[model samples]
Target: MHEGEGEIHADWVLAGRALQDVWILPGIFHGTTLRIPDAARHGWHIFWSDPLHHYYGRQLGRAVGPDIVQIGRDDTGQATRWSFSDRMPDSFTWRGETADDEAGPWQLVAEFHCRRAPA
Candidate 1:
C-alpha cells in the first residue's frame, strides 16, 4: 500500500475455495478480510474486520466487466462502494467511494494503485 510517503503491506492467502486478505500498516493499523464466492449468484460475499479500530464491514462483490470488480454495502441507509480495476498479472488499482443511497453519485474516499511483489 502507498499513502503520502509511507508504505503498507498486504498478504493474500487462499483457504479452500475462499481467499483471505491480511493488511498491515505497522503499528497504526491491521485488518483481515475474507472473501467467499457465491457461485449461484455469480458474485462474492466479503467480510472485513479491523480490531484496532473496532470496525467491521460486509459487502457483496460482483464483476462489472472483464477487469473490474465492484463491492458494495448498504447498511442503515449508508452505502459504500469499493472497486478493483485495471487488473494485470502484476498490478491493479483499487478505489473506495461512499454514497447516501444505492442510486447515487458516489463520492471518492480513497484510491490505491498496487503492484505485486516479485517471487
Candidate 2:
C-alpha cells in the first residue's frame, strides 16, 4: 500500500433501526474484513485505509474520505449518511520507490461520533 493518499467518499444502506452502534472503516482485498465484530445482520460498514499502489505501478486508495459518517434510523428503516469534508483525514500513506522507508506508518487516527436511533 502507498504511504500517501487523498480523500474519498461512498454511501451505504442499512437494514433496520434496532442496530445501535455504527462504525466507519475502509475495505481491504475483500470488503468483508472490515465487518463489525457483532453488528446487525445487515447494515452499511464504512471504512478507510492507508493508500496502496495499483497494479499499473500507480498510486491510489486514499484513507481520507468522508468527513462525518453518521448512521441513524427513522420510523421505517435505517439510514447512513455523511459528506466529504474539505478537511484531510487525521493521517495518510503512500507506496513510493523504496519498499521500506518507514514514515511512522500510514495508520492515521480518526474522530468517531455515534448516536442512538430515534425511538
Candidate 3:
C-alpha cells in the first residue's frame, strides 16, 4: 500500500485452514462498498472510500486526484470513474452512461462467502 492508501482483506490458505487480512498491495486503495444480489452466485460490490471526509491522506482528494475504480478477477474488466468535489457529499451516487450501438451488452456473475459474525 502507499503511504496512506486504504486496504482490503484477502483470504489465504496454510496447513489445513485459511487466513484473512488486509490487502497489502502497494498503491491500491481500500474499497468501501460491498453490494450484491440475493443470489449466492451473484457478483459482489465494493465502493471506494470518499476522498474528503473519508480517510485518504493528509491532503484531500482534490489535491490528490479523482479515481476510477474497476472490479475484476479474470482477464475481463469493468471500469467506472467518478470525482469527489467540494460541492458533493461524502456519500456516492452511481450514474451509468447511455448505451449506444457501439457499446455491446455484457453480463457478469460472481460468488462470495456470506458468513455472519458472532453476536
- Tens digits of per-residue lDDT for model 2, 23-107: 2243422111122222342333333232342211111122234432223221223222332244433432211222112232223
lDDT of 3 by residue, 1-119 (tens): 12333334545434424333343324533333323222343322333343333432111111124432233222122333222223333233222221122133423222122232334
Give the clash count for model 1. 0
For all candidates, the clash counts are: 0, 16, 6
Worst 10 residues of 2 by lDDT: 53-62
Which residue window of length 10 is worst by lDDT in model 3? 55-64
Put down candidate 1 lDDT per residue, 1-119, tens digits, no spaces: 34642244544557477778776666556877788889998898888777898767788889887555555664344677888889888887878777886577888887877777667
Against the true structure, candidate 2 has what lDDT? 0.27
Where does model 2 exceed 4 Å of error?
A: 14-34, 37-119
Q: Model 3, residue 46: what's the lDDT?
A: 31
RMSD of 3: 17.5
In angstroms, the error of model 2 at 71 is 24
- State each model's CA lDDT, in order: 0.73, 0.27, 0.29
TM-score, one value per model: 0.79, 0.17, 0.21
Alpha carbon deviation, residue 55, candidate 1 (Å)? 1.7
Which candidate comes out best when scored by TM-score? 1
lDDT of 2 at 30: 12
